[model samples]
Target chain A: GESVGLHLPTLSVQEGDNSIINCAYSNSASDYFIWYKQESGKGPQFIIDIRSNMDKRQGQRVTVLLNKTVKHLSLQIAATQPGDSAVYFCAVHNSNSGYALNFGKGTSLLVTP
Target chain B: DVKVTQSSRYLVKRTGEKVFLECVQDMDHENMFWYRQDPGLGLRLIYFSYDVKMKEKGDIPEGYSVSREKKERFSLILESASTNQTSMYLCASSLFSGAGELFFGEGSRLTVL
Candidate 1:
């Protein structure tokens, strides 16, 4: 069965600290991966994406790393802030399924002062 | 900014009632999707359309149907709303096919009594 899953259900971090969220996928055919951030009552927003052709991709304050060898993907947030507290999800796109995304259970990040 | 707009931000319905959720995208995307977000469970894809009038079933398509009458509009129909069907419904769009970054609209929180 092809599925995407997160390593942890929740993460607590202090302000100004770096945060890392992990995701694992079962589909080897997956070539494109994306990270999304969702606020309390909002939809998922794109943060960063990494293709299988590249090991890493970086956005303004976020970085996404793709390790095809282990079928792992990770999102790293630099200097986590209160505004960064949200649920983060990782999605995978396989060539076999055009336009369909397999999303992992989200990790809720809580940044405290 | 890429805009995906959902028709309703919140909705309340009774069991056995038919419900409709509409989504529109301004990016001239070829793909549109509907997903439901629930507690503990991640985003589950209900349905997606790669092109107008071409709909496909996603992982969790039971109890839901989709319509893509036009390129910019996609609609999710719940044949009979149930208490178990209450969830946060998200709509998304992507420019082309597989591996494209998805742009999501603010979700519509539906409550079925």
Candidate 2:
């Protein structure tokens, strides 16, 4: 079974600052990617997503960057808030294989006031 | 609005006891999923249903069974709960039609003593 690891690279940002959380995926054939935000005692919410054909996509206060060449994806949060503190996950899917998402080990983002 | 809701926020059961976890989705999405989250493991798929009465096994399906009699409901069952099965269980849903983003529920933390 593909399992997420406990150890994760963490990033800390002050309130009103910008935050960027990066992840490196293992499978190169993955064509779609999404970023999820999980707060304490809550389920994960969709932050942003980017397809493999594109390099970057932006949403409300969030941006997702996908680099297929490096099998890397990143989430950028603009004007980080204390409420933005969360464990962020990157999930990849291969369109050719029924599109099951393969998740990367998440990164923890701590936004300080 | 909560798109997905789990039946319990926490559960305590003795070893070898049968347990059931219920989930319901209100968005009318065709895809419903059950996943377990551990301290080190982010989220592992236990089972998923694409439609009523249809199901598929995800990355980790051992010791688990699922039932999906209706489009909006999905249930996970542990025939015999073990200490290894104690973890946070989450349910999610998503639409088909080429859009692949999942909306998750606040997890059910189960403890098997």
Candidate 3:
């Protein structure tokens, strides 16, 4: 059974601090990964994505690091702000399962003032 | 701007009732998916379609069915809704067959009493 899981259920950080969310996947053959952010009343939006071939990928204020050896993935948010407070999810592409993505239970990030 | 629109924002229905959730995408994407989001469970794929009139069952599709008569419209049908079926249903579309980024709708929250 292929599964994606998060290390933490919730994370709290100060307004200007950096935030890190961690995820672990079971399938070693999985190659593509994605990070999504969901706000209070909105659908999850894509934040960043990385392939197995790439060790890290950077977006505007976010970075995704993938360690294939450990089947671990992490999202780093620099200078986390109030608007960055949301549930972050890591998804793995399951090629065997009709190419649908398998999403891990998200980590809720709260940026306090 | 890619847009995926869900017809209903929220709905409440009694047990054994039939429910229909509609989703439409404007991107002319070849891939469309339906997933359910729950607390501590993240998102679980229910069904996905890669082409018109073609549908595939995802990880959790036992209580749900999907219809994709048209390329841009995908509908999720609950034959007889149950209390356990209450969840937030999200619809998403992607250009590729689940390998690319997915554009999601606001989501339709259904409560089965």
lDDT of 2 by residue, B3-108 (tens): 7999999999999999999999998889988889886567787888888998898878999999999999999999999999999999998886224898899989
Question: Model 2, which residues run further than 4 Å from truth?
Answer: A1-8, A96-99, B97-99
**Would you list the rank order by TM-score, best first?**
3, 1, 2
lDDT-best of 1 and 3? 3
* Residue pairs with backbone atoms closer than 3 Å in model 3 (clashes): none
- The residue pairs that clash in candidate 2, if any, are none
lDDT of 3 by residue, A11-87 (tens): 99999999999999999888789999999889999999998889999999999999999999999999999999999
User: Regarding DockQ, does 1 or 3 come out ahead?
Assistant: 1
RMSD of each: 1.1, 2.2, 0.9
List candidate 1 segments past 4 Å from native: none
Q: Residue pairs in steric clash, candidate 1?
A: none
Give lDDT tens digits, candidate 1, residues B1-113: 88999999999999999999999999899999999999999998899999999999988999999999999999999999999999999999998686889899999999999
TM-score of chain B of each: 0.98, 0.94, 0.98
CAPRI tier of model 3: medium
Instruction: Give the alpha-carbon lDDT of every model.
Output: 0.92, 0.83, 0.93
Error at B56, model 2, angstroms? 1.2
Candidate 2 lDDT, tens digit per residue, A31-97? 7788899998999998888888899999999988877786677788999998899898887677443
Q: What range of 10 consecutive residues in model 2 chain A has the weakest lDDT sum? A: A1-10
